[model samples]
Target: MAISEIQSVAERPEGNELAGRVALVTGGTRGIGAAICRALAGHGASVAAGFSHDRERAEAFRAELAAGGADVTLHRGNVSSAEDCRRTVQEVVDAHGQIDILVNNAGITMDRIVSKMADADWYDVIGVNLSGTFFMSKAALEHMLERGSGRIINISSIIGQTGNVGQANYAASKSGLFGLTMSLAKEAAFSLKRAGRLEAYGAGITVNAVAPGFIETEMLDSVPEKALERIRSEVPLHRLGRPEEVARVVRFLAADASSYITGQVWAINGGQEM
Candidate 1:
């Protein structure tokens, strides 16, 4: 499908359910991350779009969204750095006054066979994909726990679920999100309970993961056409997933209606796994 065919948020009829909320999305300037930003902002959330580099692209994205009447700001920093993650989170809160949603979508790939992978390859992928999620989540959780409400969405990958060749480091980092999501969910619950803020009617802090499969994004552009065809054939749907498809799910998980759901991984792979 042409990118133009994907429906814009303005085209949708849903309510502005996210009005007044603020969202911080790491790696939010392009591809799936960009789509996620559009989804949230389209629903009326103030968006903080985080990008590590490529200032021109980031600015263009902001301009496009701003022209569409979306409230968005650009935050630049490397998610791999703990201090950078902390500072990014702080900057979001400082600019937006509060953070109601945090999407740990920033990640990197240092793909190679286990034996051939460099130490930097393994550590770099783990640092950004796993530790970055931890650092950002911890910073956001501090503020979320105080308020007794928030959402933390981690973007894992299908490769994490069904490991792929030449992706040992990537797989380890992505799969690790499951443990972190569940653990943080439990910790959030315990903290809320200890604070006497875990009311039956209210939705307290929640943490979850969304794993996407074979999405049509620039990340896959380097793959040869024949390989892409093989991947498409492997999917039951016989088509590559769209970035917006992933974004829609992320938006759903971010909403108040999803308050009861937490500590679970939501797969958007078009029956590729099951």
Candidate 2:
């Protein structure tokens, strides 16, 4: 099937029965994160979207989703801080009772070669991408384990797998996320088995990652048109990916339809890896 036409198997099975599930999407005020929030809400999952510093933008997003009749709440917090991650997760649980899905989508890029990279830049990127995922996952796992069911989908990148020229920090952080996914998947399974809920979550709480490439978002707006055109030409599909395209993959992983999958990275790069 064509990439754009690939629909997640989850939505097809549950239909609208997802009404009671709660989802949290970090950095969800805009771009790919926003798309993920919208798609999940549309499918009946109550969504909580997080933003770092843009109160106005975050409020606006809440209003937009609400206007469309989506059960969405906005939370302001920096994912890099463990305190913020804890607070955000608490807010979601407080409002919704439990968190069924957690999307670790907040990340920042400080593109520079290793030789030219500043200590501050390296630290900042690692703090947000690697440490942030760790903190959020740790916080969310508590609730997921108690409930014996949940989904954690980390947003990684093609650059993480196939090294990029000027993103050593980004590549390392994303590569680390893959390792985190595997370890957590094993831990989650063990915990479920101990709780005697092994079958309940044999496919119950799956942790996965979605790696995207050359997506069209504000991050790439600065690229010259010529450069973007060249990138599109190189892709096997000859196109830059849309944020919604990545969001669909996230929606699938978050839903029960993906019950049997975990610790896997779904690359939405239009064959770039091949």
Off by over 4 Å in 1: 1-13
Whole-model lDDT per candidate: 0.91, 0.89
TM per candidate: 0.94, 0.93
RMSD of 1: 6.8
Against the true structure, what is every candidate's RMSD? 6.8, 5.0
Q: Which parts of model 2 are misplaced by more than 4 Å? A: 1-17, 200-203
Best by TM-score: 1
CA error at residue 74 for candidate 1, angstroms: 0.8
Best by lDDT: 1
For model 2, how big is the CA root-mean-square deviation? Answer: 5.0
Per-residue lDDT tens digits for candidate 2, residues 180-228, read 9989988988888888887732337899999999899999988899999
Candidate 1 lDDT, tens digit per residue, 198-271? 86646578899999999998889889999999998888999999989999989988877677899999999988
Question: Roughly what TM-score does model 1 have, to 2 decimal places?
Answer: 0.94
